[model samples]
Target: MAGGITDTGEPYSPYVGLVYMFNLIVGTGALTMPRAFATAGWVVSLALICFLACMSYMTTTFVIEAMAAANAHIRWKRRESERVINDSDSMSDYSDDEVIIRDRVDRSETRPILSVQPGVSPDHFDIVERVEMGQMASIFFNKVGVNMFYICIIVYLYGDLAIYAAAVPISLMEVACGNHSCSAGSSIKYNDTDSCWGPVKRKDAYRVFLTIFTLLLGPFTFFNAQKTKYLQIMTSLMRWIAFTMMIILALIRIGKGHGEGKPPVAELSGVPNLFGVCVYSFMCQHSLPSLVTPISDKKRMNGLVLADYVLILGFYSLLSFTAIFCFDNSLLKDMYTLNFTDNCDVIGVAFLRYFLGLFPVFTISTNFPIIAVTLRNNWKTLFYREGGTYPWVVDRVVFPLITLVPPIIVAFCTHDLEVLVGITGAYAGTGIQYIIPACLVYLSRKRLQPVFGEDMPNKHRSPFHHTFWVIFILAWAGSCLMFVTANIILTETKH
Candidate 1:
């Protein structure tokens, strides 16, 4: 043992691994997943969640095991470098000793002394068997172009909270209080040809304001680059708190009656949209860290599989079931969270607002590192300066500029939050999270065989085996394209 509790080669504590994965997998994604289920039909969506959970568990564990192997290789290399430096120093010290002895000894004795054998060969000291785990990993990932494509796919899949949808719950809250000032419903008349209802092609000012808030929040993510350690700790803490709040909310909805009878069709539709948001938002990249832990200890990775499923399904089921009673599917809006008003005491509302705001902030912060990495790769070549002197220019100027685009389009185009989330989730969600990862896993596995000389056992084979991913990839892509078409069909031209 290295010390009191250090195994020197052990994985992180099982509890910590579970906690981290729960946060990563169920984080922002949960917020909207409930509504998505309601939209897709609760029965079908529930089945899919179970299926995805299984896939995620198996895939995540495999990736972590692979990462641990690579970590072992890196440690081996570092130790070898240190030994080389130490051996050279020892040779210099021995040469000096020989010189001192030669000056003091008779010339005739030198021949006899030279015949004495050295006690040990320095080259043999601390010899470690070479393991090409790192090279194996690189070959595995690069062969299928996964290392490059994975991040892009993740980014594309993470289509989350459109600032435009922020208006939905706000409008719902206004209606609950018997106020019609910002009601999007009253402002529009449906036209069969245009296929949507809105203020005779008018702008939704309130939605625009919400969109502005979403935009303002985007750049704030960059602030995280300044303090990663603190952010991680805080993120861990906040995630738990968020999870707890969700559970409590679910419980309350379960125990209490969801209020009077059947909800409207629109509200029901919002359910699926909300569910989509939660599912997509729950996705996180923390699974990537297992790539650094030792193999012998990699079993700890399974803890996440257990934690994410239990908590995620628990949270999602409760939220969806309660939503069935309390909300009319027809009245569904984007920020259904805002609709949780009747369930709130002062403290609950405060927590709700805080959580709602905190997630966007955190999501933006988490996303910044990725966007930063991407920008650096694409733009750094253009700068051609040592240490990337103009980095601040990109961070300070270019990022904020880029951040504005999505919010602006959303502000003008979107009137209902539920509709917006559904559109984004159906298209972006399918592509980024499910489809892309499946492709990377398949391609990366092919690369691993040639390099590692073996296949990673799939105790948990993807439901359809390798071919299933191909089917899934195409399915998700088709869904995304279809949703985009729906958006075009439903949209009304602004004159």
Candidate 2:
């Protein structure tokens, strides 16, 4: 169980693993961050983003350590099975419970004090297998806890898919509508009812683009998303290009002394949304097993992870600062790239303007299918039965349809990226990022203490290995949850 050899992907160097994590972290959430920061104010936004980044990194470490503990527990189970198989005279006669009781007593008594520190064997307990978060939940959590885990991740992935779904069409609609088309510069903000093509409204154009997006990328859900290897590379290149362009364009504007932005020192009213966006931006916890387990060498794994966090934090800061300072708070687009596309004063090159205008389409289109497939697989995992396979139709059709349709409907109803990202991140994002990892680490440590002994150490242990961190994370998640919920209620009441 410690051995993650079940995964078929080739092992890569830790540096490559770090890069993949970087790519994963700096995705859709980052695109919407400038607006969030602008609304939240630079001073408060900077402080909160920094705190969230550190908290996110801490939780990320907790997740890695939990994965190691999960693998260790599997190894223990296997060894226990082997012991029962070989020691038939002592184990065969009694019931399973009685056997466990006797086995624990006998093993504890015979084991040497120093050797009882943790492992049945240190080598055997390595985290070789890539146990996904869901798999780890099944292994360590009780029936209710496992069910809750699946529910949280499923909802988060659905929110992710919806954001990806809405973003592409919104980008396309902006480029298509006469009001926003990058063929010329316009500072005027248009309503959804504004004309796109003659009689068609911008909202209609959005729906049409959504349909095209669904048709173009939706079928990848029926197959393995890993087949998009080439596409992933292409989109990644485009991401760097877009980010660099945005940053450079912003810096150039700021340097010219034409910058219009003057964000307040602090704005408490905006903190709820800001918190959500920050939490969402830093979300890579769920996919850690895939990224971390593939590393060929992990001696400096923790350091590599820390460096990645620092770099990402700095990049996010640069991007947000340039954006908020380069454009006025009211003028900053929800998708920061749109600001360039919509303003000739900022970026006059027609080709670059079009690219910035439609960049979300390029990035989100490639990602939608992968996310859909992940959500589908999670659905399957939730309902999976022992020794039973899903029906052909259910596996191939039902799950994919369920995964694809909801998000499409969501995009149809609302193309507001800020609201979508904010609500999703504040709720489901909190679960996957903060609450779950803390619970996993706490439960995993407790689970291992009996078999491995209290003194046993997980080489993959996090810097925040103390019980207080776990409690603090839980408290943080609870507070964030309440804060967002209360904000929602108040906003709705005022409206």
Best by TM-score: 2
lDDT of each: 0.45, 0.85
Model 1 root mean square deviation, Cα atoms: 11.4
Candidate 1 Cα outliers beyond 4 Å, as residue runs: 1-11, 65-258, 261-279, 285-287, 290-296, 342-396, 415-420, 423-428, 455-495
| Model 1, span 346-371: residue lDDT tens | 12444464554344445444544444
Please give the TM-score that candidate 2 achieves against the real structure: 0.92
lDDT by residue (361-407, candidate 2, tens digit) is 87787777777888898888788877999999999999999999998
**Candidate 1 weakest lDDT stretch, 10 residues:** 122-131
Best by lDDT: 2
| lDDT, model 1 | 0.45
- Poorest lDDT segment (10 consecutive residues) of candidate 2: 112-121
Over 4 Å off in model 2, which ranges?
A: 1-5, 89-121, 178-186
